[model samples]
Each structure stands twice: as structure tokens, then as C-alpha cells.
Target: MEPQKINKGDRNKIYFLVIVIAALIGTNAYLFFKDRKQSERFVTVSAEKDKLRLEVEKIEVELDKVNALNLDLNDKLVEEQKLARVKIEELKASLEKAQITQVELDKANKQINELKTFVKSYNEQIIQLQKDNLFLKNSRDSLQNTLKNISNKASNLENENSSLNAKVKTAAVLKLQSAEIIAFRTKSSGKKVEVTRSSTAEKLSVRFTVIPNEIAEKGHHNIYLRVFDPAGNLLADEGNRFEADGQEMQYSHSIFINYNNDNSTYVIDWANPKPFIKGIYTVILYADGNTMGKAQVELR
Candidate 1:
């Protein structure tokens, strides 16, 4: 049997096949290793991102605690705390992206560490602030104790002066039920009707009801009324001054009513000098040295 030798063309074809097979094998090896490296890089980056996110969340929790402490910190510290929280939020958002680079992860790690440092510093400051607040609170408590002793002595003195105090306090107490100011005018037929127009406003009718009080002394009592314009100026006539609890004050009008242990109604009319301005007017009632009631009227 004669062995047939391979032709040059066939040899070339076999070499070409071998070369193609070798190239494919090399390409497959390269692809496999490359995929493996990519997977490893992905896992590493994911781990870093997750770790940073967790760190950010921890920082967020600490920041919330700091804010919830309600410490009276300086404005600069407040701003710093706000900035730290914002940074943590930003880092979390960035880490949640679909794709992140190693360099970016590195930067995030650095930023997170810096934030941790900032939080530590902030915590130290908070501790110091707490100490200082405790000192201040202790000082305040000590002062309060001293003031309480002084107040006890003063209370003893006040007991010695109880009679005059009772007189002043009793004279200043008032139990008013209702107070109102009505604008009205007299018709030509000598009839009075309610009017809202300032031009027709001729009288400010002040009406009030005083309820009975067992604590208040029962006798003839004079009620004083002070009317004020919108500009907070007292509206009163000349020589309308009287002393209420040793304080001299000018009043718009005074009414004398026999208040006998029961509800008493009184009305005092104030003559308007000119047309009342279209604005809000305030009427305050005073008896003794204390304000009893207040009413407001709008003229249009």
C-alpha cells in the first residue's frame, strides 16, 4: 500500500484550520477571564456602595438624634448639621445609581469618613453643650431656691400688710358679664334709632351688665369708661379725670349704679363732638384700679 502525501494546498488548509482553532480558543479564554474580572469588579463595587449607603444611613440616624435633642446650639453648628445630613442624602442617591465607578465609590468612602469625623465632632460639641446646659440649669435652680426663701420672707411681710392688700385687691376686682357699644341718633320726632353712618352718629351708647360676686363688696359703685380711636388715642372731654385705685386717669364718661348683690345693667351715652371717623373704635371699662371689660365698635 502506497501512502499518499498531503498536497501544499491541503497542508495550507490544515494550517489555516489550526490557526483558526487556536485563535478561537485564545479568544474564548480571554472572554472568560475578562467576564470573571468584570464580575469581581461588579461585586466589589456593589459591596463598597452598599457599605457606604449603610454608613450614610447610620449617619442620618445620628443626625436625626442630634436634631431631636433640641439643643440650643449656635447657628454655625445648626448649619453644619444640616449640611451633613444633606451630604448623606446625596451620597445615598449617588450610590443607588445603576452604574457606579470604583473611583466614585472611593470618593464616596472618603466623604463618608469625613462625615463620620464631622459627626464625632458634633457629638463632642453636643456633650459640651449638655454639660454647659446642666450647669446653667443647676445655677438657675440654686437661684430659684434663694428666690423662694426671699419670697417666703416677703410673704410674711405681705401677711403683715394683708388688710390694705385686701382692700386694694377687692376694690380692683370686677365681674362683668357683657359690654357693648352702640351707635345711634335721635330722629327729628324725638325718637332714637340705631344708625351706622358716621355723619348721623351723634351718640355712642355704652351698655354693660355686671354679674353679682360674693367676693366683691356690695354698695354703690361707679363704672368708668375710656374710649379710644383707631389711632390708640384716648377720646375724652376736658376735666373728666378721676382717681381709680390711686391712679388718676381721664375717662370718657362715668356711670353711678347701685349694684346690690345681683346683675345690674347700666347705660351711659357719650355725645359725639363731630362726625365719627369710619374706623374701629375701642372702648375699655375700668372699675377701681383694674380693667373690667373691653368692647370694639366699627363705624362705616
Candidate 2:
């Protein structure tokens, strides 16, 4: 077959078509490569954003732990957390951009590091606070124990002083010695003599000498005398009672005497109330709530 040759205008049109096709293919290849590079950058940026989010979440978890401590800095912790959250949101928005420069990434990382530092500082504060609280508690307990010990000692001392006072009081009681009871007869001429018989007795006499006591009070004291007949009969003024040895006792007679912390003699005389019985009479003396002495007299 003989080939037909194309004219010059048609050839020029074919050359333009070929050049346009090559330019279209080159443009498509450039667009495709540009889109692929942008896609890769987006994936890297997305990964970095997710990683930063995880870091923020980790800091939030640490904040939760510190909050559970219930420390005094909890209010500040909350405020710091609020600011950190805002910063995290700002970082999230920044990282969401299609392209992040190295400087911008460095700034984001710096913000994250500041947040981490805040958490670390908060943890240190909490630990130190706990240690301080423990120390204060120990000091308070120790002080209370010391006060209790002092109180106990004071109470013991008070009791001991009271006991000593009681002993001193008991030791200061007056005593009598060399005591005697006698029966006397009074003559018409105002003379007194020992009775020859019980019927002849006109008066009963009691004599006692106070023993010297340095601690006993020096003052006028009443000496109580109790006279009992041998038949257990008390010859005394009826219903005449006084306190002696912590009990009420009847006294046949009482005599006033000045005691000067020295041996002092005293006498009490009572006219025979009735005829004296012919037997032994017992005489008991009391002074200062104590049985001072006892004496006896025989009459017939």
C-alpha cells in the first residue's frame, strides 16, 4: 500500500496536542506528589498531637493523685490545673494546623515541660507538708504527756503534804502525868485533912501535872475529870458531857488551867455529892480530846 503524506498545518496541530498532553501529565504528577507530601506531614503532626495529649493526660492523672492528698495547697493545685488545661487546649489547636514549624513545636514542648515542672513542685510541697504535720503531731502528743506527768506529781505531793499535816496534828495533843484523886475532910476552922472513912469525907479532890510538850498549844485549857465508883457507878453531875478521844464523855468535874509548855500542876475540888462508897474509885482525866491519865483512890 502507498502511504499518504500529511500537510504542514495538520502536523503543527498534532505537535501542539502532544505538548499539551505532556504538560497535563506533568501537572498531574506534581499535584499528586505535593498532595502525598502534605499527607505525610499531616500524619506526623497528628501523631505528635496525640503524643502531646497523652502527656497532658498523664499530668492530669498526677494532679488527681495530689488532690487526693487533700493538702492545704489544693486550691493552688486547682488553679494551676486550670491554667495547664488552657495551655493544653491552645497546644491542641496549634498542633491541629496543617504545618507546624520547628519553632512552634519547640514552644509547645516547652509548655508541656512547664506543666510537668508544676506537677513536680506540687508533689514536693505535699511531701514536705506531710512531714511537717507528722512532726507537729508528735510534738503535741509529747507536750500533753509532759503536762500529765506534772499533774500527777503535783497530786502526789499534795497527798503527801496532807498526810504530814495529819501526823503533825496528832502529835500536838496535850498529856497529863502524876495524877491522883484524894478524899478530904474539911474542918470547921477551914482546915482540910485526909478522910479517915468514907462517911467522914466532905470533898473529893483531883490533882494532875501537865507533861511538858514543845508542840502543844500554850493557852488556858479545861481538864475534864471522870470519877467512877467501884460498882461501875459514875459519880458526876448528871448530863455533863464533853468531847474526848473523838467521843462524848461525862465528866465529874472540869478545871481551868494555864498551860505554858512546861510541867504545871492542877487541882479540882468537888464537895461530896453524896456519901462516898467504901470501895476503890477510878479517876480518868481528859484534855484536848485525849485520855491524859488515870488514877485511883480507895476510901472506907
Candidate 3:
């Protein structure tokens, strides 16, 4: 077949159609590439937003932990807890933006780092407080123990003092030995002789020996003598009343003697102001608040 030759008008129409088809294909390719690029950008932005949200959640969790700790801490840690919570709130508010940029995310991340540092500092403080409390408790216990020991020692000293006082009191009592009583008659010539008749008796004499005791005290002592008739009548002199065992009683006679912690004999005499009518007279001697000895004298 011979090649067909087209005229100028037909060739122009064919060239226009070819150009229109190339334009349509180029427009489709451009639209497809633009749509794919837009979708990729959307995915990247969405992923960044989700990651920032996760970072905010992490910060919130840490803040919650700090808040929980604040509940258990003392008033001293309250301000720190409040500041940490404020930081968390500020970070969360920043994340509420419609579009989160990388710069903003970085800023939030810095705030989180600050919050973490605060939490670490709070933990250290709590640890130190616990240590201080333990030290104080130990000191208090030690002080209590020392006070208890001192009290015990003081009590022991008091008891020892009491015991020594008792021993000294016991050692100071005087001992008495042989006792004698005699009735004598004094004549007009002032000579004394033993008398058995009551009509002739002028005086009654009492004699006693205080035994030597090294433990007893040496001092001036008052000796009291009491003489009683057979009818239980006390032969007391004027102004001879004294105290003995919290009671006042009359003594026949009293004499002051200087004790030297040696065996010493004492003689006490009672003059008969009236006539002696005693069948038997009892004589008692007292010294240093105790009975020293007793004796009896007989008269006809």
C-alpha cells in the first residue's frame, strides 16, 4: 500500500490532540505526587503530636508520684510539692495547643527534667530527716539511762547513810553494872553510920558502877535516882521532874557526872526531910534516857 499523505489541516488537528493527551497525563502525575507528599507530612506531624502527648503523660505520672510523696511528708516539704505540681500543669497547658512544634516539645522536655531534679532533691531530704530523727531518739534514750543510773546511785547512798546512823546510835548506849543501896543515920556530931531502924535512918544512899564502853560517847551526863517506899510512894525532891520517853516523871534526886568512857562508880544520896518509916525501899537509877540499875534498902 502507498503511504497516505495528510493535508496541513489534518496534521494540525493531530498535533493538538497529542499535546492535549500529554497535558492530561502530566496533570494526573503531578496531582498524584502532591497528594502522596501531603499524606507523608500529615503522618509525620501526627506522630510528633502523639509523641509529645506521651511525654506529657510521663510528666504527669511523675508529678503524681511527687504529689503522693507530698501527702506523706511534713509541712516543710509542702512548698516544693506545690511548685512541682505547678510545673506539671504548665507543661500540660502547653501541650493543649492545636499544633505542637518541636521547639515547644523541647521546652516541655526541659521542664520535665527540672521536675525530675526536684523529685530527686526531695528524696534526699527525706532520707536525711529520717537519719536525724533516729539520732535524736538515740540521744533521748541515752539521757534517760544516765538519769536512771544516777537515781539508783543516790538511793544507794541514802540507804548507806541511814545504816551508818543506826550503827552509831546503837554504839552510844551506856552500860551499867553493880548497884547498891544503903540506909545511914547521921548523928548530931555529923557522922554517918548504917542504920536498920527506920526511926534512926537519916538518909538513903544509892551507888552504881557505869561499865567501861569504848564505843560510848564521853560527855557530861545527868543521872536520875528514884526511891520508892513499900507503899509505892515516890520520894521526890522539889523541882526534880524530867522527861523520859515522851512522859514527865519525878525523880528523887539528880546529879551531873562527867563520863570518861571508863568504869566509874556513882553515889547518890537522898536526905530524909521526914521520918523514914519504910520496911523496904526501892531505888532506881536512870542515865541517858535509859534505866541504869536498881537496888533495894531495908529498914526495921
Candidate 4:
């Protein structure tokens, strides 16, 4: 075996060829593993980017919806404000109408109060007039009886002169009962009297009778009435006449009575339109220039 020994140069060449082959195989395996790892990393990064883009798009859509809702809410607020203003105007108008109605109601109440006062005054005047009418009818019956007795005695004395002279003396001494006032009231015709509220005028009816004695004369006798106001001032007559207490007064009313039967009633209606003060009034009656009777009346 020693005889065929190999040369050193050939052995070196063989070992160098083996090293080259090993280096080539190691380079090919490293290149394949590095490429595969790079490809997988790229795929993972692409998927992550897609996921982030989708999430951003979803957030933008939600923001748009929120903006639309905000706009709708703003429009609703504007409409509500307008409606509030209109309601306030209507309330103001209603309040003004109510105030006007209240004023009208107050005025009507005042007018009603005034009318009530006027009606009360009218009723009082009617009651007083009725009481005076009953008093004048009784006084006229007594005066007629006195005149009949005197006429019978005078007829018997017509034939004898001395008896006539004696009869005249008897007549002078005999005192006959004076005329009595019967009733006094206001009247329109024969009916009971009524006064109109606006006219302030009243019609007075006075009735009386004269009672004759044994020597009573049968003729017309004069009767007069003097009216006094609340202040004791004499009432003026509508007719122009200037006289007082006997000389002929500026205002005087008179009546005449004729004796007939045992009794007779005389009625005189006097219409007066004078304004009377509210107080007590006096009426004085005179027959044959002498005071016969008096009456007092209140005029409120």
C-alpha cells in the first residue's frame, strides 16, 4: 500500500472542491427562508390598514347623523318661539276686552241706583193726598139746616110790622155755626188726584159746607184760603194781584157758597205749578174775612 501513495497537491484540490459545494448549498437555503418570512409580514400589515380605514368611515357616518339631528332640533326651537309670541298677543287682547266689560258693568250699576231713589220719592206723595180727601165731605152737611129755620120764621113776620122788627133783632143776636172744612186733596177730574213726576205741578180739591142757625141768611158767602210755604212766606198767585191781609193780596184765591138745604158741599180745584221747598207747609182757610181752619202738610 505504501508504494502507491497519493501526491499532496491532488489531495488539496479535492478538499477545496468539497468546500465550494457546501458553501453553495448553505447560501441557497438562507435565501429561501428570508423571502418566505418577508411575504407573510407584508400580508399582515395590509389587513391591519384595511381594518383601520373601515373604522374611520363608520365614525364619519355617525358624525353626519348627529349634525342632521342638531339642525332638526334648532328648527323646532325657532317654531316654538314664534308660537309663544302669538299666544302672548292673544292673551293681551283678551285682557283688554275684559277690562272694558268691567267698566260698562260699573256704569250700569250707577244708573240703577239713581232710578231706585226717584221711585221711592214718588210713592210717598201719593199716600198723603188720599188722607186729605176724606176730611172735607163731613163739614158741608151742618150749614144747610140753619138756613131753613130762619126762612120759616121770616115768612110768619111778613104781615106784622112790629113782629118783623122784633124778628130782625132776634136775627142779629143768633150766632150760627160757621162753615166746616170737609176734605182737601189733589184731583184731575172727579177721580182721585195724581201728580206727574216731571211736571212738578199739583191740582188741589177743597170741599166744605156751611151750617145755618135759626136766623141764618140764605145767600152766597165768600170763602178764602191763604197758602204758606215751608219758610212761612205767603204763596204768590199766578194772576197779577198786589194785596196782603185785606188790601187785596198779590196772590189770593176765593170761593162762594150758597146756602140751600140743611147742608151743601162746595168743591174748588186749584192747579199750581210752583216749586215747593221740602218741609212743612201750612194752609189757612178764611170765611167771611175770618179765620175758619188750618192744615199742615209735609212736602219731602
> Which candidate should be chosen as best, given lDDT against the real structure?
1
lDDT of each: 0.85, 0.82, 0.79, 0.51
lDDT of 3 by residue, 1-300 (tens): 999999999999999999999999999999999999988977886776677668667756755665564335677787776877787778777877877777877787687777767777876787776677778889999999999999999999989989988777656766567888888977779888988889888888877787777877788889888888878799887688887645778998888888886677878888866789958889887777767768888888
Query: In model 2, which runs have C-alpha deviations exceeding 4 angstroms?
Result: 1-112, 184-204, 222-256, 269-284, 290-293, 296-300
Order of quality (TM-score)? 2, 3, 1, 4
Q: Which stretches of candidate 3 lie over 4 Å from their true place?
A: 1-133, 197-199, 228-250, 272-280, 298-300
Per-residue lDDT tens digits for candidate 4, residues 1-300, read 459767899999989999998998998888888888877755654454344334333433433443454332345444543553353344334333523343443443343344334334422332343343334334444445556666666765665767776667445331224322222334656555444331343544455554455465567766666677678887756674433335765444676767554766666655444664566656666554345566555555
lDDT at 116, model 3: 65
TM-score on alpha carbons, each prediction: 0.52, 0.61, 0.57, 0.32
Model 1: per-residue Cα lDDT at residue 33: 100
Q: How big is the positional error of residue 15 in model 4, measured in Å on the Cα after superposition? A: 99
Model 3 residue pairs with clashes: none
**Global lDDT for candidate 4?**
0.51
The TM-score, computed over Cα atoms with residue i paired to residue i, of candidate 2 is: 0.61
What clash count goes with each model?
0, 1, 0, 18
How well does candidate 4 match the true structure in TM-score terms?
0.32
Candidate 4, superposed: residue stretches over 4 Å from native = 1-201, 238-251
For candidate 3, report its TM-score.
0.57
Report the Cα lDDT for candidate 2.
0.82
